[model samples]
Target: MKRTTFLLVFGVILSFSQAQLDTGGEETGGEEEHVELFTTPATKMGAATSDFGYNLFRALASQEAATNVFLAPISVSAALTQLSMGGSEQAQRQLFRALRYHTLQDPQLHNTLKDLLASVRTPGKGLSTAARIYLSRRLRPKQDFFGLVEQQYGVRPKALSGGPKDVTEINNWVSQETGGKVQRLLTKPLPRNSGVNTVSAAYFKGKWVTRFGQSGAMENFQVDGGVPVRIPMMQQDNYPVKMGADSDLSCTIVQIQMQDDVSMFVFLPDEVTSNMTLLEESLTAEFVQDLSMTLLPAQVFLSLPALRLSYSTDLLPLLSDLGLSDWLADTDLDKISTQSAKLASLNHKVAMETVPEGNQYPSAASSAHLSYRVDRPFLYLIRDESSGALLFIGRVVNPKDLMI
Candidate 1:
């Protein structure tokens, strides 16, 4: 049998919740400690848990603290969890804590992920989650890791000589998985003599329940503390959406539904300037959960940026700051074939678009339409509708910000 070691190092960027427990959580918890990731009958509690994980990551990865930062917390979590299959004990602990699940101590976490992936991937879902491992020609991981990686995670390892060909192959895989939304993941040359590589990706093409007009008009938007510029604002009048104001952060919160039980939450601060700091500080899991509970459904006019955006990030330093420095520096890969190697790179890329509504909608009269228009800098989250699990979190200050 060939010994195989995993190179669970992934670099991805581009992409971008809730449900009923229908999972029977209480029965399992009483007899076993396997805190079913699906811990409730209604996807709400589990969704709440997943949303918290995303927030924890957002807190750590916000490099431009006050600028336009976008990410799929779900993508980040999935990528790290995929890496955990090959991590040492200490590394697993650190990764768990960073993901806000350190104390749960669930033995079935990975298995739960397997089940969740299966349920979410179906016909016409409009969302895709994928994982791939590319092993260096010279390195062979232990047999068990290879088997588990494929059997449980649904990822098949592709062996390639690490060079220009492998780079193109890896990027091509990402492009195919994301339906060509993401073009290239590895723009820079790969580190020579590397033994492993990993890639985790998510892609979602959200179709609006109530479509916006195809041709949007240019409107003035406030970005970066009082600077005004014209950006195309996708418009839909009398859009039925949930709305609320969060006093804790003085931000207005809006939630709009997409197909397949997914929703988008927008956080617009009352005061345009100096509020992002407060808004970021207050965006905790508890805050999100409370907002989900309190938001009331209403009719309003909605205007959001009609631009496609993509981001690429070098995540090693950020991961280090989130308490994984030791794992990166003194990694123990005894679980895999004892091929000594450190995490070469962790990059992420995501592409997201707010497309216009499909059919012409008759204008419905509603007073809320006069007041609710997102014409300035704000934060947005796309998530599961019932569970409120975050799939993507991003800030929009410039419509052309990192257009991919």
Candidate 2:
């Protein structure tokens, strides 16, 4: 009962407004403790129409925050609910089937991936179609889904067959993919006569297109609001400006538009030190709206101090926060069985290295690389270069983000 309740909550969040029940809310006064369930009908919707490329940026930023390898398939149940395709039960079944196929890497995984392309009804529908086709192809021999996966990540997908012991192959694949940033996850040998795992990865290596002088102006960076750190600060004046709402989160978004139409949105409180949790907890359609309305052009002699950060995290907690707990469960496997068996958990790791590419912007060029090392999670995505439509989404998040 408890597990079912939890899955229910996740289903609501992933499907977005499909459930139409208050699964999340603070109770007030003396009232009966109630469980919320989906009762309202859903409508087929398009991507956020107001914000140009909004979903694209949001998806990319989410991938950046993932410290370890991340893998998650499209929530067919959740997605279908938005499209008004079926009842919650039907959606749930579809989602489960997809999960099962990915987990077990069944040849059926290919067909399942193909079937999903037909039903997806979202903004940039064409892009979603191409992405699904690519993911299905990865399940075939000699067809590498990772290369076709489009999104930038760092992990490989593992097929679930025989038993939960194929950790070695997963680990070796991780080592090769990440260039030795992480290692060793499984505690035992893979079962004999297991099938192959299907995985996807994204790797980034970028430096400031304009390299900052090794010896440059130094200033104090507000590490934790006031906790200052004397760091190398890179100064920029009159850089190309593109602004957007960081409303999807608690922070105000500030973007530095670059060549090739790629840009980075930095998430920080309107005023630094604001509890990040405000943005973290209240992130949703309503919250994103608040931020989007407030975006405006601003001018300043911006100073971005140099800092090197490397960290990794297990995605279970964050995914749970986003209402995506099924991927981490034993029973909620994607219908990816290559044979008759299922899987345990998808695992992964990630790493990034950013440095100066060398230049003075107006005087030169600037660039950066965001690389991911995924050892466990494998489902990933890729979007259209211009339209921001989600092109591909897959899952491989187990025993793959480690260094071989």
Candidate 3:
């Protein structure tokens, strides 16, 4: 398989609602308790959504090998799932299949998602997610569907004013929800004939648990095609990280801790020119969870680039490629409105930035001999340690290509 210079970044947040699911009883203790925590509906839903996130990333990456790709899988899945509530049984089935949630028949999926979203939006986590549904003024949503969406998804369907003001209002909502990290999500107004449109946005700006030292002079970052560009590189000596090598994927994996129980995992190929097709295919929720548990901890001299990447794009084509073309074109959402309504558009925007900031001071020289330098294209993901949810997944083919 041909390799592509790719970076996958995923983030997970702790679940605040897990405790509510626990029966009020004496301690089951030890391994059993651990199993219980992982088996919660919310956690399972998180895994399912994470799998969807990986698949979505694959679809986007295949379209353009050189361009960077970023997305908040949870946000997209949340929006689609919420919309599914207003869809016919067949429509629900189709959407579920696309989301890799066909096998999950639990009725608590929405409830679980609500809890998950709450946990994801917990203050001080440096991460936020928002999803909303916009309807054409001519379509009046059924009372039941409107109430369900608001109750479960925490968002009420808003009627589009069918003017430029609609665009501004939607953009303003997204900006406010994401702490202003994402602005003008919709540069132009939606099509006048658009029936139902969904928007999702996620923002993250996390501080490392151990901050990197001051950035050194500009360094040469090797791009995919042997091209190099000067960029600021953050350096830290004796940085505590979980580092390992995956022989199957032919890449070096490193896990750096961030605040709020979030960890950023970076997958660096053995060579800058190495292909990442295999690694990309190997990514799944189960694989990531297993890998996270198996890595060994060590202190290494770490060199990483300061990254600020913002990506916004219409996901209709990508979702269509993921077996949702029919759903996008036409679907039975009769529950939402007496008149026929189909998904008109699906838009997603995400922003992520990593600076040299950290919770602790840098350590002095250590007894470690290994060095991990991310000077080339790689894959990274941010994962929440508590819920095991993937908050963000992205690839950086070239830092310069994504700087904004």
Query: lDDT: which candidate is best?
Result: 3
lDDT by residue (tens digit), candidate 1, 1-404 = 11111121111100001121123233322323323334443343345346554554455436666566666656566666766777788877767776666644556777765665655554344566556666667666777877877777776666677678877988888888788877787786567666555665666667777787634688888776556878788876677766666555677778877777777888887766523765665555445655554455555667777757877665556766556677777756555556875666666777777778643363566434234678777878776755446667777776645576
Predicted structure 1, TM vs. truth: 0.81
lDDT of each: 0.63, 0.30, 0.80
**Could you give candidate 2's per-residue lDDT for residues 1-404 as a string of tens digits?**
11111112222123433332342233211233212111111100112211211322233335554322222123222221121111134434443343222223233433333333333423222211111111121233222433322221212233334344345655555455444433443345433543222222222233343333433356644433245445454555434322333333433344443223223334444343423433333332222322222233333234453333232233223333333355334222223322332222222233333344433443333321111111111122322223222222222111122222
User: Candidate 1: what lDDT?
Assistant: 0.63
Query: Total backbone clashes of model 2?
Result: 73
Q: Candidate 2's C-alpha lDDT?
A: 0.30
Off by over 4 Å in 2: 1-172, 178-201, 206-218, 243-252, 281-299, 317-343, 358-360, 363-385, 389-404
Question: What is the lDDT, from 0 to 100, of the residue 165 in candidate 3?
Answer: 96
Q: Where is model 1 more than 4 Å wrong at Cα?
A: 1-38, 41-61, 103-105, 123-125, 136-138, 225-227, 358-363, 366-369
Q: For candidate 2, which ten residues in a row score worst on lDDT?
A: 37-46
Q: Give per-residue CA lDDT, model 3, range 119-148, as digits (tens).
A: 877775678888998888788778898888
Ranking by lDDT: 3, 1, 2
